[model samples]
Target: MARESFKIFYAGRNDVILYEGVEEVLESLKQKYVLGVITNGNADTKKIGIDHYFDFNISASDINAGKPEPIIFEEALRQSGFRAEEICHVGDHPVNDVEGSSDFGMKSIWFNEKELDWPLDQKPNFKEVNSWSELERTVESF
Candidate 1:
């Protein structure tokens, strides 16, 4: 069936490339914070070899809800059993990741690796980091 074929292709994920220093950052952060991943994409941390670092991974497909939707964040809150204020979400997408998390009352960090401008008109209070090292420091400061 077509669905089964798609699953095979998706599971292969031959093109999944990690950014530099990702493992280092994840390793360091895992030592301190209760790390979780909330993603709209199908990037399996287990397949990517980073599963041990996170407490849980929430994907849009899992809940039938995508980012910028409160339900997705609500699910994260439910799974993590943490108050929104107690969590700091670090993501690259301005709207989906940063705004979505911020609007849901979680602190957000913009992973601006591309050096792009803040695209939104009303800038919410969020930190921006261009590198994994900077991200770690920012999270620690939270």
Candidate 2:
């Protein structure tokens, strides 16, 4: 019963707030590149008020699988009609976002919002950003 209740509560959570300047950066990026979201959690963009900005969204619920697995990344590739080299995935997670995308052949940007150190055993072989401004600059350069 507890597990079922937890599931129900989690499924109802769709209010994901964006960080400062995210909307502006996302809008800017949309003008230049195709933007999509690959999330491991429940993120209803419509409720968050950013649905119009993305080309598509792939969530764990949609695929029945999560990141660090290639299936989700492959699905994004299929839907966007872009080759692995043409796409870049940006996220905060060390393994799920950085290593996962890198292993699958897509470029990755590690958004270390909290200034956390990389895991001791896993050196990031990718770009890292501390803020959305940094990310915007990086993405614009590509």
Candidate 3:
């Protein structure tokens, strides 16, 4: 048998640097909201060095489901002890984050870093944030 070289993608190998002002904004929001993370990616917050900021992290692995589904959001809502209306989920994906949250009866802030137009079909009018600063402002307003 011939040996074949393979590339295995390890989650921790990639850089995990926080965006500028992320820590400060997290620190401020931590004082007000019960911070939680619901991500499709397999990021180790401890390895990323931002685990301290989040009260809880609900990954796909944790719930056997990912975004665009109410299960994960419901789990976070349960953990948060807040009404669905009081919670705001911020995500980059239009359908998964914006539309999904709306469907689940939670507010959403869509992070559109490129300032792209809403895709015609999934044109959700959720609050759009172009930068972390904008996200912080939007979250603070809630």
Give a tens-digit lDDT track for model 1, residues 4-95: 99888888773567888888989999998899989898868888878899999998999999998999999889999999999999999999
lDDT of 3: 0.83
Give the TM-score comparing model 2 with the true structure, all chains together. 0.89
Error of 2 at 56 (Å): 0.7
Clashing pairs in 1: none
Q: Compute each candidate's TM-score over C-alphas.
A: 0.91, 0.89, 0.88
Off by over 4 Å in 2: 1-12
The all-Cα superposition gives candidate 3 an RMSD in Å to the true structure of 3.0
Q: Which residue pairs show collisions in model 2?
A: none
lDDT of 2 by residue, 69-89 (tens): 999999999989999878999
The best candidate in terms of lDDT: 1
State the number of backbone clashes in model 2. 0
Q: What order do you get sorting by lDDT, best first? A: 1, 2, 3
